[model samples]
Target chain A: MLLKIPLAWLQLARQKIRFIVALAGIAFVVILMFMQLGFQDALYESATQVHQKLKGDLFIISSQYKSLTSQQSFPRSRLYQVLGFEGVESVSPLYVQFSKFKNPQNGEKNPIYVLGIDPAFPAFDIPEVTQNLDVLKFPNRVLFDQASRPEFGPVVENFHHNEPVSVEIFPYNGTVGYQVNVGGLFTLGPSFGVDGNLIVNYATILRIFQDRTPEKIDIGLVTLQPGTDVKRMQAALTEILPNDVKVFTRRDYINFEKDYWSVRTPIGFVFSLMVFMGFVVGVVVVYQILYSNISNHLMEYATLKAMGFKNKYLLDVVFQQALLLAVLGYIPGLIISYGLYDVASNATQLPVIMSPNKLLAVLISATLMCFTSGFFSIGKLRSADPADIF
Target chain B: MNEKTIVHIKNLNHYFGGKSLRSQVLSDINLEIKAGEVIIMTGPSGSGKSTLLTLIGGLRSVQEGSLKVLGWELYGASDEKLVQVRRHIGFIFQSHNLLEFLTARQNVQMALELHNEPDRIAKVKAEEMLHAVKLGNRINYYPSDLSGGQKQRVAIARALVSQPKLVLADEPTAALDSKSGRDVVDLMQQLAKEQGCAILMVTHDNRILDVADRTIYMEDGRLFKEVVL
Candidate 1:
């Protein structure tokens, strides 16, 4: 009943400039938290985009495989072994390698991830990739990623205008180069580890990497019969497969890639540290605001104590101010962070976007951060002595 | 202690500082204030009159005596007990100590708010008390906009709004001019008498001596003289 006066809000609103400055400081920290968390989420999401797009219930990779960015090839004969298991519908070999792509316009070279698949089977669920399978079947012809970083060249632009886009490709450490034409465009974007992506037929990939033998492959896509137990099938294949290779359900494969980026990389650690720094900065800023506010009004508080109001009532006032700052500052911070996410997504061509979970996470952290500050500043309010007023 | 007595203090002793540096602020103080009584305490600075006033109002611990207000003992009392006693007594200070952000009526309403009265009733009582103090026209004005006399009047309205059993005032008119000081004391005496609550005020202004039914003096932490006006 005592607090129904909205005393906290009235006190804050009384000083317009100081109130705005406090909210702005808090909003700035909120933006910093959002960007760091956004980058971290984008790192995980972008890394697993290709894995999610591949059309298969189960996958096989070499035991030495660290991530998609790494080149780990297993014997193709091992992939053929999965067909012998019951309920197995079909299997296709996928070759992954990073090769040098020479921009057609400036001849600038950058490493591009190349996916080599047999055109006879639809290896990807992407509509653009599956519809352009015939183009990839032709030798030395590839489908370029429309979402790939623009540094790779204007392949998407030229291909859209029905103009010829031909570029040269070289093996990771090879001297000679092979020419390939961009026949179509798809939408698999770039990640932190890989700059651009290309899809080509299996034969063209072997020709580009002359040292690679037909018996070796990077990934084996295994489609199962409809309504079959994918978990049981995975267990059966994993038991029989040689120790040289490993089997994973599609979900586990995505997690494997995400784990490499989120848990095993220093970039992930840095993002987490930056977020914590934002929280510390937020606490200090809010503490200064609340502490100074308490200090400035020490006399009135002492008078209130003399009027029979308890410390509990005064503490409630300070904590209420903290929660108000948390919620009020969060609005502008979230709005501005969404704008920044668009800028970063466009500039980097990574999957940087806002999600409901991220929104809730930032809000909860902001509240906790402000509460921690309130907890620190109440020491001053509790010391206000009624006898001092006399 | 008589049933009509509002405050009873016997052998009250108070000290400041640690053992080696200890100095007595109040010594062997005995006093009694009855219902509807107006008692004024006059003393020089550092004579412990303010300290004694704070103890009677439960603003400070009783330290070494049997001190009772509204039938509640304050010696060795918990913080909670002090607060409960404080709620029954209204306090007015020299500086007017009004919250700068709150309007005059709201400042007066703060006293009644402690009783958990409904907002509608508190607002009415606060406005009526402000009118009684002749501040009806300035009910919506914040402390910054009011003059010194008006602010002190608002403090009096706040002190009497709760219908407290006793009122403690410390130099309530110290900051006002002659005319304003006279007006402030007149309003406080009139309101406290109408509410039937005893008044204990600590001040040095001799001009308002006739307003008190009895006047006492403190010298060197002891009650030195008394005069029944």
Candidate 2:
């Protein structure tokens, strides 16, 4: 017997109001889910900016550092010690400090992180910042994100509370501070959360922060030479470094960072809950709409049954209708979600990266919702007897 | 008398509800419809005429005795088999039962399509059936746009398009006026004789009894008597 899927679709298409309502309900849920997915990704990108760009073969940090973005600091001496180990090609010392920069336009001071790096190093740690070094070479100049410039002006004073916003370096043995000058701004996408970042040369940082010990630094990025076994190098370095230090390969660290944020933060949970709610809402609304439509057309369905349509054929009609509504509605919902993401990103200063992975996840979730909603009505479809019409 | 019987019911019994409040709808009923016969089942309301029709059409379960349509025994048949039996037996309801969404032509074509006939052939057959019912000018009109008599004609056309071995119609002309009702019954009898298909129609209108090849009177869930005119 021929299935009536096409006939069911045609029937749905004829009822313009019902068709539109069902489609819009599914689309609304899909858009809600996509937005939540974007927000979760944005949070992760903001928290792991340095980790993503460093792309190091290995990360050597103090064992006391629970997370890559944690406040733990280590000694600069570890870099030289790591370099002495066989198979180690290069080591870069990185300093991280937070300070406030005054906005020339609004006179408002925005909190910012200043990343100190050595230009002559291999620059493997942060190619994005190091490749654009000309902007950093200008005196009192620093690179700021284009997205952050609206709040903080192109130039600003370094003074806070009648004193230069400078702090003493622990290991470099020098005072480190500088007047702020905005250099070229670039897009870092939605993954980096820093509103304003200051990139400066290692020498400039050391000159400003005085009385810092040369052996102590905040973090170190390590690269292995060609054909060098990273595991062997890590083992060799472990012997010389103090018990307080730790070593991790690139893949291990990325997984560790992702796991850390996903487990330790409420952001992941909140987004997951939003996604779950989106599914529940989608199913409920679509189910209610379909159930009502079916109930309204109960007699009609009985008539079809009387005409010798198998229950399976009747169910195929319902599933086909649901599938069509989901796919048709998802298109507009995806477009609306992207537009909303842009507006929300600018308004909240949060990165809403709409990556392929995130989009795929949202689409799958939406289709699953439609399937579930359509599935919920199978029992009713089977029990609808043609004899009941009399 | 030797003609093949398209439908045969023997001691058929049906009951509604359970032990505490059981009610019999059909009891000890025996009916036989032969090829090329136009049979009318007449009774007052609640006399089980429609119930007997439903039983023979495979729309209701046969609770007690044997019921067979087109040589397929319904009591022992699976639901799938019952549906198969129904495909060869066209049915018309009092309410017309035409899909409101489909045009008159499309409505009639639905049965043919369900039988897996090619679309081109199904459409041509549907159009021819509608034309025979004198609905040629209203092919594209939805049920909502058709008059009562026109809608009934469309329903009749749909029933006949499948070229069924048997046709079961319940109160087919009850909702139409005298002239339209006569036209519908006359057309149904003529089509039954022309196609050599057995037709069993349930109605209370005694005025159309002259068109029936055989008439069976039902009362209190059993065949009360028979009339040959």
Best candidate, lDDT-wise?
A: 1
Best by TM-score: 1
lDDT of 1: 0.91
Number of the top-ranking candidate, with DockQ as the measure: 1
The weakest ten consecutive residues by lDDT in model 1 chain A span: A1-10
Question: Candidate 2: which stretches are off by over 4 Å?
Answer: A1-5, A66-69, A77-81, A122-128, A131-141, A147-149, A155-193, A202-216, A231-243, A341-354, B1-3, B19-22
Q: Return the TM-score for each candidate structure.
A: 0.96, 0.88
The digit string of per-residue lDDT tens for model 1 on A163-219 reads 888899999898788998999889889999989999999898999998888899999
Give me the runs in candidate 1 sitting further than 4 Å from their true place.
Answer: none
TM-score of 2: 0.88
Indicate the residue-level lDDT of B139 in model 1.
94
Candidate 1 collision pairs: none
**RMSD, candidate 2, Å:** 4.5
CAPRI quality band, candidate 2: medium
